[model samples]
Target: MEVISGGFHAVFPMEDGSRVGEARRHAAQLALDCGLDETEAGRLALVVTELGNNLARHAVRGRLLLSPRPALGEVDVIALDEGPGIANLERSLVDGFSTAGTPGTGLGAVRRLARQFDIHSSVPGGTVVLARVGAGPGPQEGHAICVGAVAIAAPGERVCGDGWAFALQGDVAALLVADGLGHGPDAAEAAAAAIEAFMEDPLASPRVLLAHIHQRLRSTRGAAVMLLQADVASGTVRSAGAGNVMARLVSGTSDRALLSQHGTAGIAVRTPEEQCIAWPEHALLVVSTDGIETRWPPTVLAPLLGRDPTLAAAVLVRDHCRGRDDATVAVLRRKD
Candidate 1:
């Protein structure tokens, strides 16, 4: 089976009131582009508008990220902010409780509109909210796999250096995570090149795919790249990497790190070696860039591994991110 993964879409800034409308328009268009009906698109637009308004009204700096899951006919909306976190999340989600003196229904409405919704916030830690809307009722029970991700630029930069993408063909799913050598436009260019290369032939082995990305990115700034392929029917995962991108497979109470060799992809890389690991039923595969703190104690990892992949990615980025750089996390779980 061949799977065509959705491309990495644009990221919208919600810094001021002016950007809120832009966020709404961008999300609505993305929903339509992903094959959502008009009704679904409208609901998504409204959710975006509400989240944007909340950011503008309360936070110092914020962004709305739009990622499409074409395989499921779904669009993911993630709203992240820097400061002035909610004081009372429960009250904020109440139907009529407003801190800005408006209708106070933004968060409530978003929950109602989304197929899946989650929010994490703290007074000093800022906020990250996730909402996923599907074109239809969603996938049937016992789907082979479910994948979700989040990528954000450095606090002061407009483009993120980290990027990720996935594709499924039959029982196999291939995932790519790339981090450009540094932050900003040149870095984003390198990451984008890797993504383009992966999409060109997503079903290739991880080593071959990374080799192709290395060739395509030689002219630009180099990046750290990792490719992971899961064979659901065989209950196994194969991985290859060049540089600092990290991959891990997590079961109910155990975590296994999938190591990557040292050296940049487009710069200096040795022959890539693919590593394979057993993936138990209901286990999760997580791939992330150096921007995230890799050494999490079991205490920190336990709660996160149980949530939806989107929310798990969001929480990990929210709690473990190294604020000085661009951060990204992608989570994949085989459905039961």
Candidate 2:
């Protein structure tokens, strides 16, 4: 799906009642945009508010991520918080995990009230509430998903085995893209494993996250990674990466690559160094596995500068991954 031309982001502080109320309003607006009925929208609003409130009462802070489902036709929200990570998944789902244990019904109520609910949480890793509106898991119509583009990791052709993690951490959306060694199954597994490790804390610095992944991947394979965070509101982008993976921050015709002298993702252990640029809301941040490196056309990236990041990235992959190995294109678009 595309971003509302004006750009969409609303910050809500933990435990701040006003912030919770504002988040509910924002959730409602998003629900309406997703074709949700009034009642559905209200329910979604409540779900979001409840989740946000829980964050305030338990985690460092909470963030609400709005994006289009695979089908641009629908909208989805991912409530993010690495706090008070649920100790028990099944028990939490059964409802009543509250520290204060009030009505002990938020989780069950949320499940019964929403159209979709997919939750991922680890006791030490916090929680990410992923929910969708509009439709369920089925073949969505139209070759064109409302988003800009769509693509997948093809077979045969050599491609970078990198997966990316993006979330609004603090003032910027932290992006972590990791590429494993060569291509094929082993590389894919390596990259996937690293992604899981880094995602434990998407906001961690490049070096820290890389080190974490390295130690974890030791049992398996290793990888190379490029981590970047851009604060469009502040017009700044910071990036660091290892291995041969490349990241380009596009500002009009000027194409610049992000480079790091450190080791690879599964092996790095150096001080993180980054380059900062005057990022623009309409600027393009393109990242991919080596399989699809530098193959993106300037034209495709130009119009994608102000669109939904995931959508735009999908389009990039769709167009370039024709005969490639596992390929991933992750784009970050800022709004002015």
Candidate 3:
């Protein structure tokens, strides 16, 4: 099983034609950094070029989210935009079907080059596309559960104050999302400490892990942290949190919000009481920090329920983020 420490390292806003070239260059370099060969990096470059150009030409507001899935030896490219949705999805994939007076091989080529691809779009809402490229095996291989998450720094800030991680131990999985007390370096220190502490013993119960993280953050600025542990054999989920980390369990078309305690980790905290809930079949568990809006409509996530967990994560942040703080959102689900 893979253990992740942070979220997406880069977010390239697709503002204009110039930004497209910049994103393409940076993404190719990211692919190379993941140990991808020249040919693989070149393939990734083309994928980014098509996605970025589409954003510049069609969307009102758009961005390309790039993250390295080191465990899978792949890079994730997710394009998010608020544009007029694809009117005829199936037809648009043909080589000559361009609504913008150019060749329409963008989406088709992305599907062929990427090792994994998934997309969700609506008539009036927007579009979210996921493409994974590199030499790694498919994401679902050798893993019983899949996770997708993203973390980005606040605007004008150099570092993100929020961080997230997950680990697998036998039949159990432990996941965490921590938001340092505020923004900037001090906040990042607290969040990093939280992740380090959690990594020490990931399979511990939620309450125990929360206390451990709290103790470890004592010398830092502190953070609002949430921890969750899911046991596949028992079909149970246990959770505990301090302060404002938000979480939800979605099954079928309904969702339930899990509660957290009223104190910050490290500074002044109570050992948060653990909450246990049944892990319904095919349900999804989502955890996030305060950078995401609390009142985001759960229904907006319906189309993504059966898609890649990372697509769900990216879509949530794309549609609901407050954009003023370091933001993060993670999704977890069992393999079908």
Candidate 4:
């Protein structure tokens, strides 16, 4: 079975009811792009519409993230909001439970239509709902770990300069997050080049893979890159990086910040070093570009570490992103 990879590719701001139809149309188009039949596409549209309406009507500041998982032949819809979280999440999922008056079947219908559904909400903090809709066979066997990410270009940019990729071999899984020097076509070229080289031989140690990516990125502009290789059988993670890429490992009540050398790939790579860290049974690993603020504390993610990897990544981006450069966050966790 193919391992799942990639991030939320499109974002639609759901500030009001006016954008619901537009988001629904975009979701339908993405469903068709994933090769779903008209029935499946319609299902996806309804999910988007319902989620969008919730964001517009009740939530404070909200948006919808759409991830086209072509490998799974599905699309992931993530609804994110700033405040006014559900007072009673359990009751809200019922067919007739609504804080704002309308025959409240939105959340219940979304759960019924989606192939998979998960949600996390905080009273004053916010809420995140993940729903996947598709027509293809769902997640298959041999998925030892879960990986999800969110990479988006800076405002006004046509394409994102940050990129992420992952590879699985036996009990080991390798993940990469790269941010080109600047935000534009050239930066995107450099970031893409790094990913291409990393996948060429992902089984290599993180240090070795960084060297290879450094060489492959010589022609294009350089980038900040971080790689993590986790061995579930051994319960260890080896990480290597350069430039401003950031990584953190969250386990139990605490989280540890992973280190990276002070040099950029391709342009000025110094002697790379591999750092091996113990991987807790339920540990969660998050890697991101400088586009995300690095000063955030662990408590920000403490309540969300156990949620869907993609949803966690999206929350990080929504709250901590710097908004000045391309941002990307890749999440990894051992499957329960």
Candidate 5:
């Protein structure tokens, strides 16, 4: 079985109150599947209900994502909305603060019940909240690498053309992000094939892995692929890619772009060249498909880079998405 399992996503339109219960049921089930005791599962269910209700009651377009990290024994609940953003975040988190005239205890309860919590909101930019609950020691206590990712299909499509996966062993990790040539089932199939190839031999060098994926995808529709490898002990990152997928390494106040070469895997192809860069302590690595605008200022992304990886990925998907194609954002950070 995969290290991560029981992941689910739901979009709750702000038009009605039906999706709140749906989100709650899904989250409670996922929490149980991740091995949370009854008490912890109940707390997670409450967190989802509060967040989902807020979305149904207030936001414009909102979504909820629940993913289990079985290796870490945790479940992550993420809520995203493009609505009237919270103006006074600190006050909103205080108990008894309510604009909708209800109990006003939702945000406060979410903060109190979750082991890890974070929220970011702004007018015109919308809001993203993340809550994590788990049974064992947290990822920060022992994990050498922590990864967060968000993948979404186009507004009307049923399957996302973009795909991503990662493998971790000891102090090293390998990551892959693939964007099939177009959107829909064919594209998704191509991306899935690439992921299967990646899973078969995840520890290969970036160039070698990309070549293998290219070979595996020859019968499919083909895709743009990027492979990345990071060595925590040496503080280095190596990346190789083809087509328009973007990669960047951010450290402190600065950001450096990692370039991919021309060509598409399994179609018009080239011998991919791996690029090496220094990854300083606390630096973050972001890999995303072309669906996101690549010119975001470092200042705007600084705060997100320091947040939970999943929340950070969601913020990028929410703020920078082009909305015309499948979108994906993946983040990697060293916990120490």
Candidate 6:
């Protein structure tokens, strides 16, 4: 399961009752970053406002996940949170049925308007709601190559805060995403170091690669490492995460989240016992950094990947981030 870095990621938390416009501008800016028109960007802003308003109040905390959708031919956003969980998901979606004592077109309206919507919620911990705005035709229509992806890097940030590695060693392809501890330079170093170590021996055993990276990255800043290796032609993929980073797959309308994490840092770190999630014909794979909140449970990344894995993953990151931190996601389409 080789994964690609979709080229955008941000997670910002919103304080309560902040003007919905603040969130609107941010979401629109993301749409704009993807080369969308003002009219299209403005339409997206309107939807973001509602999702933000819900999180600011009911959830108490909210993160905006946005990214380019070249793969899907559109841009997208997901407003996620870990606050008071929804009491009535069905009622909450109905128009003008907000518990806020204020009027709302409701989450359902946001769902209706977007190209796609994916949500998972529970009481006490809030929800993860996703929205997609298709820009045009995507990158996967008629393309052929061993693999394809979108990559991003800023001047000093040559080392992006989020790290990814994918290479074919015979029939198996190595895949992963790492989130260095916190944001800024330190986080970038931490993530880059581990990634460099992995790239050195992409064909090595996963456990061995993790061990090598843990030792190398501790000198910088600690980081979470999530790994995946697969040969689509052979129909086999294994996934594991050291910290919160996870590997997920979406095929058609279904999504399967891989959940097996060890230790955060690779060194003599007290690794968490390993746990593995199943993968069967997963078309798109997503790897994310810590900026994406774990508080918002339920995996929504895979489903949104239908049209474009890169854009879908980026949009998910932008929708569910804490902004104060550097957020990143890698999107990759499987060969199988």
> TM-score of every model?
0.78, 0.52, 0.94, 0.94, 0.86, 0.56
CA-lDDT, candidates in order: 0.81, 0.59, 0.84, 0.85, 0.81, 0.61
Give a tens-digit lDDT track for model 5, residues 1-336. 122212224344445578778777767777777788888888888888888888888887887766666666678888889868999999999999999899899899999999889999888778999988876766544448878788878778877888888787767878899999999889989898988898888888999998999899999999999999988998899999999999998767668899899999989778779999888777788999988889876566676666777777888877788989888888888874
Ranking by TM-score: 4, 3, 5, 1, 6, 2
What lDDT score goes with residue 201 in model 4?
A: 80
Model 4, 168-217: lDDT tens per residue? Answer: 66578899888999988999999889888987787789999999998999
- Angstrom error of the Cα, residue 310, model 1: value is 1.0
TM-score of 1: 0.78
Clash number for each model: 3, 10, 0, 0, 0, 28
With a 3 Å backbone cut-off (N, CA, C), the pairs that clash in candidate 1 are 1-169, 1-170, 3-168
Identify the candidate with maximal lDDT: 4
What lDDT tens digits, residue by residue, belong to model 2 across residues 1-336? Answer: 112111112334455556777777767666666667666666677777666666666665565545434323345555666565788777877766656756667666777765666565555646666454554333222212111212244454333355555555335667666666766567767877876776677666665765677688776567877777676457777777777666877756677777766576555556656677776545677777665656565666564455455445544543455455555666665443
Query: Which stretches of candidate 6 lie above 4 Å from their native place?
Result: 1-4, 69-73, 138-160, 164-174, 179-183, 186-227, 231-233, 238-336
Better of 3 and 6 by lDDT: 3
- RMSD to the hidden true structure, all candidates: 4.0, 18.4, 1.8, 1.7, 3.1, 8.2
Model 4 Cα shift for residue 258 (angstroms): 1.5
Off by over 4 Å in 4: 1-3
Model 3: ten consecutive residues of lowest lDDT: 1-10
Instruction: Give residue 27's error in model 4 in angstroms.
Output: 1.8
RMSD of 4: 1.7
Give a tens-digit lDDT track for model 3, residues 187-228.
998999999998888878899999999899999999999899
User: Candidate 1: which stretches are off by over 4 Å?
Assistant: 1-41, 52-75, 80-108, 115-128, 134-142
Higher-scoring candidate on lDDT, 3 or 5: 3
lDDT of 4: 0.85
